[model samples]
Target: MSQDRDAGARLGDSSLLRKLNLAAALGAFLKAPSLTLRELRAVIGVSRPTAEDLLAELLTEGRVEETTPPRQPSSGRGAGRPARYFRFRAESGYVSGLDIGAHKTLAVVTDLRGNTLATSRRELDPELDAAGRLSAAVETARACWVEAQLAPSDITGVACGVTGTLRAAEGVHDVGHGPVGSGLAPYSLPGFTEVDVPGALSEGLGRPVAVANDVKLAALAEHWKGAAQNHRDIVYMFAGHRAGAGVLIDGQVHQGRHGAAGEIGALPMLGWEAAVERLHARGAELARSAGTAAGREGEMVITSAARQDPESLAVLIEFAEVLARGAAVLALAVDPEMVVLGGGMSRGGPILAEPFRRELAKFTLVPLEVVTSTMGADSVALGAARLALDTVFAELLAVPGS
Candidate 1:
């Protein structure tokens, strides 16, 4: 009996090692466009036979495919026959990302490597009930999948980003009582905090869903493919009709204990609410004078400022000063290397960047570079897709029964 138990232990150890080798080979393939047997063995530090075995298994599973290397010109020196190479099958599956905000819901479909394949957007009434909003988000996701010509089974993972703090309990995300003192309540969907966001999205979309704060996802988007990609520690400020922030430390989002790591705008003393209201009031006045709809008043104000409107520029400068105060608080605490300004206000471009940088410099102990988001309104949804891709890779690389 003791001998049998020892043999079982040996089998378990061998299985674990095999799993590790397989994961390493797969990671190498994902990073490089293609790899030969010798190249893969060198990368994973495995024997030639072991690397070949792993590639065979991956090929059988349809996760990898062989391809001929590019032809080389004949020279006096023999470079040897071009070695056959293998590449990861990034088209093996797909994932979906959804951004459900107060005013709009967006869905994006992506391949394994986070390349956008299809996208759909839907406008939502801020007064819509929680159920109505959830239904709209689901519809948008389905529309995106249809546009991509993919079936539900083709989706390997899904993630959703929403406004407000998310509290997870038994896989259900309870969006907490919404943000405070950010002047977004008037524009937020009613009763959004009282629903299970992940559960609703998962059921409606016919798949499991991961949920996160929209601002946090925006920060992740910046880290993944935006201005902060090269920086590890960052402060991502979402300056829209409402104000919020997201923090990244050591290249990972710092969500605090309850996933509220960057709710500094919630503090009434920060004056975030007052500043937003001031912008809104001025925008409304500008819109009325121009005989245009006030739907995008804040943007109008920024546009006017861009055109050298003195009054608009002054309001923008004051808004920047107020924003700098809250940003300084975050910068002082985290000492981030960079701060990325995103959302609608960022579209003001240099007209906004100059004043914001000038004001932020007044409070920070050390100088920090501030850049605008290039992802624009799609940042949250793109971040959601990234999260979904992560889930797919985790599952793909997971070792069974270990």
Candidate 2:
């Protein structure tokens, strides 16, 4: 019996080692796109046989495919025939990210390597109930999936970014009202807090789903492919119809025990609410004067401010001051390497940068670099896709069959 138990332990250890080798090989392919057997063995630090075995398993699983290396010019000294290569099959499966907000729902579909393949957007009525909003998100995702010419089964994972904090309940994730109630007042969707965002989305999309706060996702997007990519610690601020923040410490999102880590705007004393109201009011005035729709108020204010309109620029400065104050609070706590501004208002980041930096300098012990998001409105959705890709990789590494 003891001998049998020892044998079982040995089997487990071998299995674990094989999985690790497989993961290392997959990671190498992901980074290099294609590699010969010799190069892969070098990258993964495995024996030639072990690397070949890993390739075989991955090939059978459709995660990798054999490829011919690019033809090379003949050398005087005959270099042996170019070695065969294996390529990571990024198209083997797909993942999706969704950004659901008060004004719009956006869906992005990406390959395993996080390349955007298709996208769909839908406008939403601020007053739409939670169910209606969820439905809209589902429809948008389906449309995106269709645009990508993919079937439901082609999706390996799904992630949705919503306006509120997300909490785990009984093994499932649920959306909750955090500090600022999704950051939009009077227009915030009703009953959003009561819905299981992940479960609902999973059911609708016919795949397992994950959920996170939209601002947090935006921060992830920035770190993954936008302004904060080179920075390990960052503070991402969402400035537009509402104000919210997302923090990254050591290159990972800092979600508090209840998943509400960077909700500094919830504090009434922080003046986020008041500042947003002032901006909106000014935007409304600008919109009226410009004969544009109310929804264009923020854009009007930003445009006028860009032109150095006295009133618009002053309002922008005041708004920047409030934003900087809240950012200062986060900076003091985490000492992030940079502060990134995202959301609709990020389009005006060039105008807001100096004022925000000036105010942030006044409030913080150290001067911090401030940058605007290059991802723009797509940041949240791309971040969501990142989340989904993470889930897929986790599953692939854990399950040998996968």
Candidate 3:
């Protein structure tokens, strides 16, 4: 027994055991309608006492529900007694998510199962500084919470999806059209750069908060409940005023070394100035094709030319081909199961999907499945909500049960 204890200690600490037990219990509960103590112990490979202790905590927390014992077979000879079972409650609480984009900010409130209860959206100008943008975003978030009629206390967390680089170590950078602190004047989020956007909003709303890049958030949302649900390795691109992508490995979002794995727009084209000019020239050409003459769309505009006018369809076709080049580069490196199209212009539906597929086929080592995001404008916000729920309720799912 002493040797066994020592070996167990060496193999895994109490904390590691608890996490493993939690994962086992949660997996069992999710896979089946109900589970028994004996079955949970067998699955977790933990001692009976440890399993019982974990289950007790879960039951006390109302995350799992106990049920009557199963019926035993008639005992003409000798029949074993039935065992009590447990399963997830699923309706315990909710989380909130928001996606703040260049043109629009959206919010969604969802249950633990990722079901949306209410949603709201507000238009925005990319020219607004980080502080100004946050103010508008925060207002939209508050309205969504109010419309849902949920108390601030009931919210476990709020997850936000913002465009630009998010350095967990250095914080979010390049939030709007200008410098982090200077550009946000109109909406008035003082010290936007210094404060953690998630933490600040969480404090204001009295809940925990999580944040991720907008494109990554959209990828996660689609990974969890949209077009990429069937795939483990995937790439999601949100092409607009700025183009970005989110890479997934085994269903997990990859942030890369700098938390900027998908900054596809920065890839060099003809070289620095020329490449920048080419990107803008496309935008200008799009505007002219749309009959705007001077060829200017709103601030940070990319789709205004592609989606709003038929004359610009040729330009969009070329743009889509360029997008395919980016996708091919990503695929050659990552080799994802599918590539999902998202963002405001993806609303173009199959028009964008087919062209992208054609362009992608021209290059790349492996054939790729390209599809449109099923979640639409709500993808990023919903993904944020999913991230929050995973953070909070995921713990409850671990408790073992009778």
Residue-wise lDDT of candidate 3 within 1-402, one digit each (tens)? 432244457765656556556666666666666789988777766677877887887788776789765666776644677577998766567788988776677899987666788999998765666666677778888888789888777677688987666777656665322344553221212345566787666666666667788888889999899988889999887755555678899999888887868665554561222322455566675566666743233221335444455534555556567777778888888989889988665776665667778989989887888888788778889889878877775655554431
By lDDT, rank the candidates, best first: 1, 2, 3
On TM-score, who's better, 1 or 3? 1
Question: Which residue pairs in candidate 2 have backbone atoms (N, alpha carbon, C) closer than 3 angstroms, thus clashing?
Answer: none
Which whole-number lDDT from 0 to 100 does residue 231 have in model 2?
95
- The per-model lDDT (C-alpha) reads 0.84, 0.84, 0.71
Best TM-score among the predictions, by candidate number = 1
User: Model 1, 23: alpha-carbon shift in Å?
Assistant: 1.8
- Stretches > 4 Å off in candidate 2: 1-17, 68-77, 170-188, 399-402
Worst 10 residues of 3 by lDDT: 183-192
What tens-digit string does per-residue lDDT give for candidate 2 at 300-366?
A: 8899898989988998888888998999999999898999988888788668878888889998987
Top of the candidates by lDDT: 1
- For each candidate, give its TM-score against the true structure: 0.90, 0.89, 0.75
Cα lDDT tens digits for candidate 1, 260-333: 68888766677787888889899999999999975687789988988889989888888888887889999999
The residue pairs that clash in candidate 3, if any, are: 129-183, 129-184, 132-184, 132-187
Span of ten consecutive residues with least summed lDDT in model 1? 170-179
Estimate candidate 1's alpha-carbon lDDT, on a 0 to 1 scale: 0.84
RMSD of each: 4.1, 4.2, 6.4
